[model samples]
Target: MDPSMEHLLARKKSSRSSSRTRSSSASSQTPSDQKPREEKSAPYRDPRYETLLNTKGVFLDTCDLDIAVESKNIPETLLQGNQTVPESTIFGEHQFEYACRNLQGRNEARIIQDISRLLVPSAETFAMLGSKHLEKVIESVNEGWNNCIPLTGTRPQPDYSVGFRREAFSNEQLDKLSPFIGNWLSGDLSFFMATYYMYFPFLSCEVKCGAAALDVADRQNAHSMAVAVRAIVELFRLVKREGELQRQILSFSVSHDHRMVRIYGYYPVIDGKDTKYYRHPIYTFDFTTLNGKEKWTAYHFTKNVYDNWMPSHFKKICSAVDQLPSHLDFGVDPLAETGLSQELESLSTAASSDIPLNPAEQQVATPDSSLCGVGAAKRPKKDVCGIASDCSRSVTVNHCASCLNQINAHPASFNIFASRPLR
Candidate 1:
């Protein structure tokens, strides 16, 4: 039943007490019904929680996240052939060729293997994730991925780092980091989104492995998109130093439940007028449902995210140095919103700073100091009028301009502060 309807039913049930009291004094009432019932009447519980009562010695329960259709149901698989690439999608023409590239001929298998390693390293998945036990799985692959991808000639080489639950992130920055339903910004590993010289990130990802991962993929996916959208906006705001936070992102949440792997993608809308920040999700798959080429396509997309690299040939760059690209191919359209207030608040803070919108020139302001001692830890600076930084006159003691001018008028009077003993 709908949650609202359930709440309405609960309200009506509570009001039934007055009617029950009135019925007790009815014209024909049974003696058995006169007595009050047991006070320990148990409340209703959701059936999903009922699994706890029927558990055995060592039990494993799971909810499958894969598309429910059986393999034999359709002749042409949705995830396999040309149908996988939508006409309006942002992907290039040759998906497999892009993902499975090698120095010489082919290494599609290498990309797939690397993606597998990224999502789940060895047998340990989210067991130690989010806790302090072990670092997130993405941290393990950062260096390898940073080295494997060829340096892009169009832009400087990137130095992507897998930062895990970093405390250095500003509260403003942390707040805007996602589409996550609950708290997700503080923990888990995330890759920086910028290329070589830049520091801010344009993309980020979250990974979950094994059966439990599939159970939480929807939740994790929502959280990942939120972060990606805001991070993209912040990155653009820093670069342009303008009102538009129009950077695009390529973010994903990868989940490998047992043998099947599900990859999710997110992209920001291209139009500057449309401030939605992110679009509907576009997703692909590997493992069972997809064939060789299809699996390669998924792997290539993963590699792209790992490298902070997007294929923008024959189009403008997304780095803001060039014209904005038409769109980006992030994956499936997710059922989530970007929570724009985080970005708005971040921008508002920048706007509220000392820099005025109409100023033709700017000046740095300093505070006046009342301190007058050499050995003090925080000796007050003598910024008489705001000219302390540029003023050349040496000040040995705190003195007004009138006294200093009176001393300077007589050259011999300067000897009073020339480290001489008082006579």
Candidate 2:
């Protein structure tokens, strides 16, 4: 070969060899050796994750409760029943004797009598006893309610919850109304109240082993009752029954320890632009220390709540459902009236306290600009990426491009409560 041509050919061969070496090195790289593509996280924080990671549980004090007051007056609904306690009824002669005997024998050691023992019953023995005794009373008065269902997997899973079945309102007219009624509530009529099967829970009970757990039980009861009252009020709000604002004690909660039982009556009232839940002390008594006369009063009160109060409350709920207008006069956003966006808050974020304990009411941004405008393509479900509205002080982000669209959109239904869930 000519000297210049040979030199050019040698340079070309060196270039090809370098290129192949670089290609081989790149092809042999492992995933660990390669740079990772950055993964963008959801914009809004998950309330449950925040709760599990950041929020600390603390027992709430009486003063820490929203609109809580100390009172001695028994609510009228609780005293409405005129039934006399018969010997066969719970806490009466026969039943009381049976309870006392059941405490004897080897189980006598488990019986909590001393105030010291009342401070800490073994495991949940005191709570179990309280539940058993209350069930007896419920059986005596449970005409067909068939409630007293225990709830689980929630922040305020009370020892007992009393609610009606979905079929209670499953009439032809209601079925027709469900579409309209369901819009005001969660998308589904079945899970509108709380869960898929339980509808319109009127009362809840949280039992504790001793006085030590009494405050915790009270907090749990307060949270549960607040949820129940809010659900009812929101239902009525949908039908625009402003007059039927929950002034009367609509929801009740029973909290008891080994020694004493406390009943609280809850109602909601409009304070300025915010809905406020009020907890009133209905009656507190020590069943163990009380005589026959006093003990029967507790039984009478329970019967009145189950038989008299609850039936009336359930009727009111049914009436509201029936009054759901067949046609829409104007487009009413169900969440608009309550200062919530059905699309902003999700079910998982509803773990916060529904009671607004602070001066600043929780607010969700319902911007004028909606992705689901006329003739616009529907937006797919997006993972919620915003602050949990529990005591949300202010909202600057009016429009979330990553969030759900308005108009028939399935937003995560968050609790409208103003504070984090009280431990």
Give lDDT tens digits, candidate 2, residues 127-173: 24453322212211111111111121222344556665555665754
Error of 1 at 84 (Å): 20
Range of the 10 consecutive residues with the lowest summed lDDT in candidate 1 = 5-14
How far residue 31's Cα lies from its native spot in candidate 1, in Å, is: 68
**Model 2 clash tally, residue pairs:** 8
- List residue ranges in candidate 1 displaced over 4 A: 1-115, 118-212, 237-249, 269-279, 284-286, 289-297, 304-423
lDDT digits (tens) for residues 157-224 of candidate 1: 11122322333333444343321111111111112322111123223333333444343433333333
Q: What's the TM-score of each model vs. the native? A: 0.29, 0.48
In order, candidate lDDTs are 0.28, 0.42
Model 2 scores a C-alpha lDDT of 0.42
Q: Give the backbone clash total of model 1.
A: 17
